[model samples]
Target chain A: MLFSYRIMAIPSKKLAKEDGYTRLKDDFKGYLAGTVFFKNTIIHGYPHIKRIFTLEEGIKRNIKEDGFSVEEKIDGYNVRVAMVGGEVFAFTRAGKIEPYASEKLSFLKEFFKENPGIVVCGEMVGNTPFTPPTDGFDFRFYVFDFMKEKTILPFDEKQKLIKEYNLLQVPFLGKFRKSEEPWKKLREIASFLNKGKSEGMVIKALSGKEAVKYVTPNADIEDIRQNARFVFDMPVGFFNQRVFRSALFLEEFGMDVEEYKKRLGDAFYSSLLEGIKQLKKEGVVREEFRVFVEKEETWNAIYSVLKKSKEIEISDVYKWKEGNRIGVRFSKIYRKTTEKLRRFLSGYAIQD
Target chain B: MLFSYRIMAIPSKKLAKEDGYTRLKDDFKGYLAGTVFFKNTIIHGYPHIKRIFTLEEGIKRNIKEDGFSVEEKIDGYNVRVAMVGGEVFAFTRAGKIEPYASEKLSFLKEFFKENPGIVVCGEMVGNTPFTPPTDGFDFRFYVFDFMKEKTILPFDEKQKLIKEYNLLQVPFLGKFRKSEEPWKKLREIASFLNKGKSEGMVIKALSGKEAVKYVTPNADIEDIRQNARFVFDMPVGFFNQRVFRSALFLEEFGMDVEEYKKRLGDAFYSSLLEGIKQLKKEGVVREEFRVFVEKEETWNAIYSVLKKSKEIEISDVYKWKEGNRIGVRFSKIYRKTTEKLRRFLSGYAIQD
Candidate 1:
């Protein structure tokens, strides 16, 4: 019973439509929504799902000969940027439209407006130290896939669209025949990501049918370190989800769930001690994600989006009107009273 | 004849002092001011200059046997975070104090306040694709060197200081023995950086007396691509300085100045063509840098720093005072009409 016959609840359609996604019926085997299963085929709108293989599993199967392409697996949130009804919108993988106007998003909005009917899927990496630091206060998006309407474009066409839009895309390592040594290529890419302070690379078929990510061990450690620093401050559920995601990532590295859970337990306690000591020291912590609306009047739209997204609740919303722009500072803050979730999550850490 | 007898004017003292630096006469050969030259001993304050060596020259000299260590060379602005008179200050390599309060800088300031007379030198990488993208709107600084007073601490002490301060530091590659193949080691490091989206590595002596940078070809291409996107928008002098610096970087890769200048010329013109095409499309270009002063009154201190730094001129200073924080949006904006620099820089592109 590795494959669970139990069907998980179907995902929210509003969320899926917002993100241009429809959840597959496959057993995801992970808490995170976007985790790709091995040999899982891409369904254009919604279709049958298959069991997904981890990068490790994929390498063992020698599937590269099936004609796969390797691209830099960006360490960020999956976002779909599209022109719906001639209006540009960016939706997170979980189907939440980013309610903020970021410089990069704004640029994309304008680009989509000019070129209607175009839809670009990119990884929006920000609000974490997953990748190397880029120049600018705005989050950067690296487009990987392209679509027109509901159909995914060919790889070459996707490249053309990226160039046409003057937008950055995930770095294409190269194409490899399934007969070629893909594990060696994976090692090469992982080493590259390690040196560049990147997470890893994603290998997809030329047809854009299947893709799997190979994350470097260093990135995993870095992710743990990053989360440990603020785990104590996060909401209990948020923290548990983070730990679960980290464990899932470790599973890809061949660490059994039990071993990772133990490691996470130790890391959590240690980080709690360190976090406590560091927290006592007074220092400014800037909220990573903030929306600067050009006009205060436009904030109503943002507010409505926030109201609809129950999963993402803002702790505070600071609105200030500058000459022609309105700066809306909203941070997802967790209250200290929620420390009770720590005990609950601590119990679930190793069990999962 | 290899050494340029044509003296580049002494670096501006006001700029250096403002940045908390004293110019040294040691022949420092590199594109940027802070690039260390091989075996060019540090001079406390300003002193007689010595001849600096290009990477090729340094390699040719077989300086690897001199107990040199290699560390990740971060692509960012050089900053010195120190405590003077029990107050925290951040100085740029040009000897200009950063005129704004940042979470990272403030954290360092408080760190220095707690540990008086400690100086931490780091690279604040931002505003370019040369480095990997960080997780926030703010730029990240990676500490490389630690000092107590004017004396440079040993490598281990530097590590200890970094750990004690709980700060990020550039990753340290392995040490190279003179007997072992240093060139191979250099290539290994270069390849690592190339894979990871980093510019290069800085090789320094175990004694901390000498250092030089080794940049990868990939980083050079990225730097060129990034600058080309915005070169048309910069002041002619600033643009020339950037081009010259890039040419200097090319020297690290053993590309002769003439060859680099020719390559730069081609890239400059091509980028100009593309930039012009993209520029016509009316889109938003947001200022990447902003200062958030915790208190409204702190704005004056930032204003004073800007006033003192002649090289960094501000176009508009927008101050919005919120509940307890003051957000100041100031940037060095060059006029669109200043595109006159295109011709001027295009001439210098191949000439300088």
Candidate 2:
């Protein structure tokens, strides 16, 4: 008789006092370190969502025939909200305590107070300092999941509980079966989303954890537009993956390829050209975003935490006192891109 | 007393019996290995030429006021043709013995007979088995340099010798001084080349190796179109470099951005869509090119050598005798790209 043993390389803890994970105590921050001992409980990071370029093939392969809910896949940062010992805390993807969420979302405290020890996972979209503006979503949180202990609650239970708490959530498009030509419906949905300049849709199985996301070509192009100013700072995959997916989306949905191609190309060249103009005229390249906050301390703490993690220089917050809130605008200088563009603009030759 | 001396690391020779280098003995082939020994002499590979995005800054920075000659830069495979022991031999960039050149060009023997041990470096363009077909070239050789021992001969000497041998060379655009608005002239030349659908030009200092090359936007787009089929097999830089250069070319030459944006985007999507269509219909992606040869055995030898170096499967040469010559066609199957595309088409999920 022979036996096989599972051979696994278990990762050891990082050296003590090592820096990387973020922590905050300004409002309600969690104790995030090796093993992330927050309120004497372990909160696992969210699983990475799988993405699909085509709807029919991807849905049939990943989802079941029973039913699936199509929800808007918002373009934003992911954050996990939880109430630990009468305090609300938000954790980022890598178990870092994100203070921005706690300061921005006031309902999180009340929502977590009613549902103790439950983690509300959602996206932080719109006029937040973390990312670019997403139309009308101004520092809003939309609940996408409710995790009890280690497992995510079923769709019905989460919906019931979310409704009871009276919290915001991503808009539910519809429920469809795999046999009902779901791809055709999805193509229509994608077209609508593309027209509105929305991101895409996520297909979630009604009962289980099976889920797959499909994005519109406009979403990919928008991603390129945002990062085009400093494309060199990112890996080539950041742009190529988007372009490749856009092509597949266009082909799969039977959309207008020529129109999308023109827009995609313009998204790349236009943003970068504008960036070049800025650098040539002002000797710098940077991102300027506005954040509206009630308290100046909240913005200051956010700025401090941001500056600690970034290599790029952060500008002092430009505060404009409104009626009751202060609108603060700041910039993150992309110095490397600035220096590189200057060299190229000033006749520095490069080999292709 | 203080003294200083240069320290260098000398590369050791490869162990005997090791494999990687190509060897040929059919006819006029050279002994190629870590050290390229041909006809009782050692021949080194050619150096890479420097490239520039804008002619204005590049010419002023790289080329001095002694005046520079601009020649049409051919988009083709580089080959160093040298006659050794009364045998004409062509070596690729990596010192591989190439028999295709010796078979197609009948005057190589006589040209080498006149100047023994001198390597004439040029490009093989149009209707060839290696690269995509360039218009009007028709498998012709264009001499760009004549090297003696190791150093490249001055422009006047190479031109005189090339003329005496009645060999075809690149069209020599008029020479111009750096201070006499050379950039404006280069823009006109670029526009003309772009209109003709030709690659850009090379500016060579009259007496020195101070040369720089600038390509047209159309050339970059053409490159993308040709390789867009098996783009995954190549580095992402292959596309990004072209796109980046095209943008700079547009900005520097003051071309219409919207027109190029449409074309550039189309170049990437159109060819790839064609490849996808072919793959979905035929289950494979490949490149087919034609080569005109005087003998069947010559085509066979060339095919064999190419197959030995490439991992991609090479198709058997198809021959059709035409009057006094043979027209041969073959294809290289891009199995990796084909397999990857098949997986995506079949709904294999991926994370971006």
Candidate 3:
């Protein structure tokens, strides 16, 4: 099933060193800079994750749809191996060369002596204190691709060499079909792998050419919203959460409410509210206010009057109180009455 | 007429501290990486007056063509301006913020104050010796691009603003008609700007979107060959010259003849000659025999053969004089061929 693997284009070192919530965002920007746009395997998360309810649900959808194959979530460092002059050297995701295990180094030296020139990609899994017990301290060499000079070796040849050399590989999960219902398949994989204290199943496209894309199994919508709420409820000001919310609000409204407030302060909000009140008294409401806050009961109250008669054009004024101070804003009304209300509100307008 | 410009992409500070040769290579490489190719500038004998040749002349037929226009090469230090927050700060190519140029700081600050949301690209040419110049110091501001939010201002708009602000720009050598006879245009510009002291012109594509391609005003082939021969004629024992010659030879033949001789010894050379004689007596002059040279005449003979051959392949053998006797063996190739050749000949390579 020709599945595209969603590769993380950003260098890992940049991601690891980032502090706070902005790290991911900045890294994402960097990734965008380096990436070629294409649809690929993507791990889905919940509420904040967007377009999905939960990470597990997304995974289940992927699994049910047979969107991808799953790989054992190896809890270890990510490394890339490069072969130069017939010798293989391991590099961390950040491009740092790692000091090889003495035994493994010897093995690798001998392997290169036989293979001559080929770069093999794999994962080094060990029993670190942070990892689960099932994943032992054994270094697993999951040979994904073998590059000779400039050519990539055939998959069959690579697999044969891996077996001949006794190189450990990631356990092969069953193949799944590629389908539009990728989320269903993802959820099933999430459920199946939920036993261990693993992060989640990494859903990689079976197509070997693309870099493996892993869908984190833990991105449940409720889980994400809960996390966001926790961040919001933290003792210190949740500037990240505030920014996140502001972004969400901006997406909904054409104007950046926070930016507007910062630029104009309470005066703008006060003037808007007073204008709405005066308009309401003159029985005129604005249409923009109606669409901006259709869910608010205050808008419905004014709409009720307008629904009955065109002559009594109702003006909707939205009001809210912070402590003892009340702020009000006018809504759009029918044209005839709106002109009359505009004149009445001019009397209360503050001079520039 | 429309003219193109070659903007330095990497910050000058980064380029200044790099190893001289590496800087040269990286300048070429970075130019390529930044979508600029075709190194059209000439590095002349004057350490301070490297000129960009902007004309072309066809040597096959003495047809000269006019090249691009000339702009004042600003004398101040190279500075990169980056927008941080709403304000822009001048940074050295090495990414260090320059403290001296208050005009740039104020210009950027005021621009940011007015625009509030853009990244401005400009050169902060100042009296500071960020790059130690061979000439007198003068400062000039050259505005290039303005990045608003995330969008880079159109090229035309950027040019318009540059003119409006009266910023010093790397002058445009005028545009010429694209022709098969490119060198004709190069020679014309060279002749036009042949002032005894001025750096020559740089011939570039009229679109400026293309990479900077150049021609030297007086780059005679004989002069280059003479320089090469001068280095080669130095005594075999002259380490620097010997290394330089070896490098030149290696570049031509993919094997270091001198180093080979050092490794194998006189006996090897004598035996190789004897072997060739025997092969000639046997009516078998293998192509490999044509490669090995026992005398200066033989070396010259081989050069003609190598020049004519599409692929030059030479056996990896060397003759060296050990004590008073000679011996033959294969030579140890340096890990980094270029560096090894430079080091083996000259006690030191050029520093940054």
DockQ of 1: 0.01
TM-score of chain A of each: 0.63, 0.86, 0.38
lDDT of 3: 0.35
**lDDT by residue for model 1 (B217-244), tens:** 4456456545544543433333322332
DockQ, Cα level, model 2: 0.49
TM-score of chain B of 2: 0.87
lDDT at position A16, candidate 2: 22
What are the fnat scores of the candidates, in the order listed?
0.00, 0.47, 0.00
Instruction: Name the regions of candidate 1 deviating beyond 4 angstroms.
Output: A1-352, B1-57, B60-65, B101-103, B109-115, B126-137, B229-288, B291-293, B297-331, B335-352
On a 0 to 1 TM-score scale, where does candidate 1 land against the true structure? 0.37
**Residue B347 alpha-carbon offset, candidate 2, angstroms:** 0.8
Query: Compared with the true structure, what per-residue lDDT tens digits does model 3 show for residues A1-352?
Result: 2122224445454432211111222225413111111122111110011121134333443333344455555545555454434444554443333433222333577676776645555565542111222323334455545656434454457668889888876665555655454545555555555334343444443333222323232222112222221121222322221222222222222333333223221221222333345454644443332122212442343345335554333345556663533333443344543553343223211111
Candidate number achieving the greatest DockQ relative to the actual structure: 2
lDDT of 2 by residue, A1-352 (tens): 1110011111232212114322321212222222233545555456567887677888887776468888898888888877666767677766666667767765678777777777888898766777875456568888888877656777898789878887788877888877677677777888898888889998888873788888888988998888888766667667767777787777776788989879977987897777777786788888887777788887776787678754466775688997888777888778677777777777776654
- lDDT string for model 2 (B1-352, tens) is 1110001111223212113233221212122232244435556556556787667887787776568888999888888887766767777766676778866664688777767778888898788778766566568788888877656787888789988988889878878887677667777888998888788898888774678888888999998888887877877678777777788777776789999888878887887788788788888888888877788788887888778755477765588987888888888888778887888889878865
Better of 2 and 3 by TM-score: 2
lDDT of each: 0.49, 0.73, 0.35
Decide which is better by DockQ, 1 or 2: 2
Candidate 1, RMSD to the unseen true structure: 28.9
